[model samples]
Target: MELSEMQALARRVRSKYAAMETARYGREWTDEEIMLGFLGDVGDLAKLVQGKAGVRPRDDLDEALAHELADCLWCVFTLADSYGVDLEAAFTSTMAELDGILAAEDTTT
Candidate 1:
């Protein structure tokens, strides 16, 4: 699926979480709370990546790594949506800038 399609799915999942949070906590989570949750997920993702690389032992390491990566992506997409950032455009621009910098360095060397 395209990035936009994935983003739409993330929004739908966020809506589901909102309903669940409202029912459980009396209100949906704040943006800060969401970011904190994302931070936790990123930490988990890092561990899973380590496990995948055999730097740490883990059961079903490959599966765990894939899931954690997806979890991180969901957090990123949701956060971007909340902040009204065009993540795709930002990513493209950042990559282009990096490429240009690397190319210039190659010429100078």
Candidate 2:
């Protein structure tokens, strides 16, 4: 799917979570809850990496890592949506900065 499609899907998932929260907890989650959820996903990715490094439960390392990375992206996209941020712009700018840094390092060495 395209990035726009992925963003829309993330929003739909967020709405589903909101509906569940309202039904179960009598209200939707606060922004803090969303932030914590994102952090939790990051922690999960770290654990998955550790597991692949043989520090925890062994599994299909490559597949597990891909899923963990996708989870991380979902959390990032969700958080960006919450804040009305442009993910494509952010990614583009960051990649440009990284490219410049790498080019400078190459020239220096």
Candidate 3:
């Protein structure tokens, strides 16, 4: 799906999770909780990738990896939205910074 579609889906997922948290915890989660949730998703993604890359499992891992990655992205999108950040611009800027860092290292070598 396109980035816009992904953003929309993230909002929906975040809302649903927020509702669940409120119901289970008896209050809305703090920003820290949301951040932790995002990190948790990232950890899950890492595990899925490692397994798919044969670090842990021998079974077909493609579906699990894809799902985990999508979940990770959803959490990232939610965090960005919560803070009123523009993900597209942030992604582009971060990638450019990484590229520049790599280029500078190449020149230094």
Best by TM-score: 1
Q: Across residues 1-101, which tens digit of lDDT does each residue of candidate 1 receive?
A: 99999999999999999999999999999999999998999898888777767788787888887888898899999999999999999999999999999
- Which residue pairs collide, candidate 1? none
Off by over 4 Å in 1: none
Q: Model 1: which ten-residue window has the lowest total lDDT?
A: 48-57
Instruction: Estimate the lDDT of model 1.
Output: 0.92
Ranking by TM-score: 1, 2, 3
**Better candidate by TM-score, 2 or 3:** 2
Per-residue lDDT of model 2, residues 17-99, tens digit only: 99999999999998788889778878888988898778877657778779879877887888898888999999999999999
Candidate ranking (lDDT, best to worst): 1, 2, 3
Stretches of model 3 off by over 4 angstroms after superposition:
58-60, 104-109
Instruction: Choose the strongest candidate by lDDT.
Output: 1
Per-residue lDDT of 46-106 in model 3, one digit per residue for the tens? 8877886778774657877787787777777877888999999999999999999899889
Q: In order, what lDDT does every prediction score?
A: 0.92, 0.87, 0.82
Q: Each model's TM-score, in the order given?
A: 0.92, 0.86, 0.78
